[model samples]
Target: MGKKLLNKPLSTRVISLNNSQIKGIKHKKKKSKKGGPIPVKELVPKSSALFFQYNTQLGPPYHILMDTNFINISLKNKLDIFKGLMDCLYAKVNCYITECVMGEIEKLGNKFRIALRIAKDPRFERITCLHKGIYADDCLVNRVQQHKCYIIATCDKDLKRRIRKIAGVPIIGVANHRFTVEGMPDAFGAPKM
Candidate 1:
């Protein structure tokens, strides 16, 4: 059993039919091949109290999944990621970092050592990824496929363009010394039918 929220008494976790938890997934590209949903006991890990705090109907306070470019570009523009995010969107942000993005920062050598420092901030939650050795861009792209409302923060031009292909995805980036958001993601985390 996991800990319950502070305001509410302990209650059974509600199960929603439309949630993105893939029970049996088999990932395959070719017609002859088949794929099944990887068994996931809980899509939102118990440790993530912030993610559990969000409700879709209120419409705001996005959960952000950051890219390495988000760090580099923000620092390059002399902005704190959180501070910049605060300047960009009206809603509060719950920030997260994937393992791959941290890995990328580490691999950048001394020139980018400052980024490694930024990644150490306790404010950002960790989004565990099953696949390793892939770039942060690929992992972030895969995340949007889950139909979750995650505002992606990055300054990579190409990556921004790539993300636009996915519907209902909001993006944040730095422009002229301030953070700017292109659109706001739907907090309900519903994929387009």
Candidate 2:
């Protein structure tokens, strides 16, 4: 025979529910009649560091771009008047030369030599020739507008007018170490400086 068993399995059992068990069951509460709670306004505090960070990424303003007539004067004088202008630019602003202007200078035959001499100088930086389709005058105007603040150093009357109409900034030339802002009269008048 087998050893006596300690516990016997029940074949059938009866179960009953308690009062707490029946009362604990509940239905979810109905949603509010006023749709939902009003949305709250989120507050975002501003920081000075963020303002300065954005300003630093913007960099400095752009420099003036010169035309052929100015380059011719610089070459004729052999005084590096361009360099002097560039020195002024360095102090108060920056200086730029367009490839179209460079090409025009190169076409000046012997005068191109003078331009080349100045090109080697560190003060002058050539503006890349991306929009080669635009004429030199138009290109200069566009650059000025893009920079928002700049003067065109040129003596061409028509070019001066175009620049004024397009850029709204004064076109100036340096003479006797002084800058003269070219007006409508000077646009038609002979080159002063």
Candidate 3:
């Protein structure tokens, strides 16, 4: 077995050191060349152009598409998912729900009764996914492929991996108390916040 730090024998020199000498200490300053604090945009080159500033005068370029798990998470947490998305995206985002997701939510039965109720929100545009299957993840991927401007809100790890494979697509995940963007497209349109 390796020698433990606490069991290690002290050197005679260290033992011989006087209390006065041991007490004195110096604070070393960093010598590396450091740049001054720059603006948020300057620090991240092309970030401003990539994540768009929310402008009410101009229409938003992106829309939010919700997944089953994402909706359930909102219902579970008692959060206004749409309001959170708008706040994070810094623009009013048109929300959409896929037929496949609805099927998945409905299948959860009474356990997800609240989520099912929330899913009936009229504000969310019901999208008929081209891939008519029971797999909600596959349907979401297909719909997103069709709508390049869509920013999908989901908590599924596997779904996130699939989304990253497609370039210029953004995925939103809830972290702590706020929503986070996983991918920033070249066109940019998230918020500085």
lDDT of each: 0.72, 0.59, 0.71
- Which lDDT value does model 3 have at 53? 36
lDDT (Cα, tens digit) per residue for candidate 2, span 1-193: 1232324344322223555656677756555568775566796443332342221111233356778777666566554554465344333446678888877766677847867667545777778878846367888876765654556788788987776654245566655544444532223222456
lDDT of 1 by residue, 135-177 (tens): 9898998887564568788889889998886655677777778
Model 3 per-residue lDDT tens digits across residues 1-193: 2455446666523433456765576656544356544334443232222334322222374578889988877666677887777767676788888888899989989999888888888988898766646788887787766546677899999999998766556788776656777564222333344
For candidate 2, what is the TM-score? 0.52
**Model 2 worst lDDT window (10 residues):** 52-61
- Local error of candidate 3 at 175, Å? 0.6
Number of clashing residue pairs in every model?
8, 0, 4
How far is 184's C-alpha from truth in model 1 (Å)? 3.1
Model 1 residue runs over 4 Å out of place are 1-58, 185-193
Model 3 C-alpha lDDT versus the unseen true structure: 0.71
Model 2: residues with Cα > 4 Å off, grouped in runs: 1-62, 77-79, 82-90, 174-178, 182-193
How good is model 3 by TM-score? Answer: 0.63
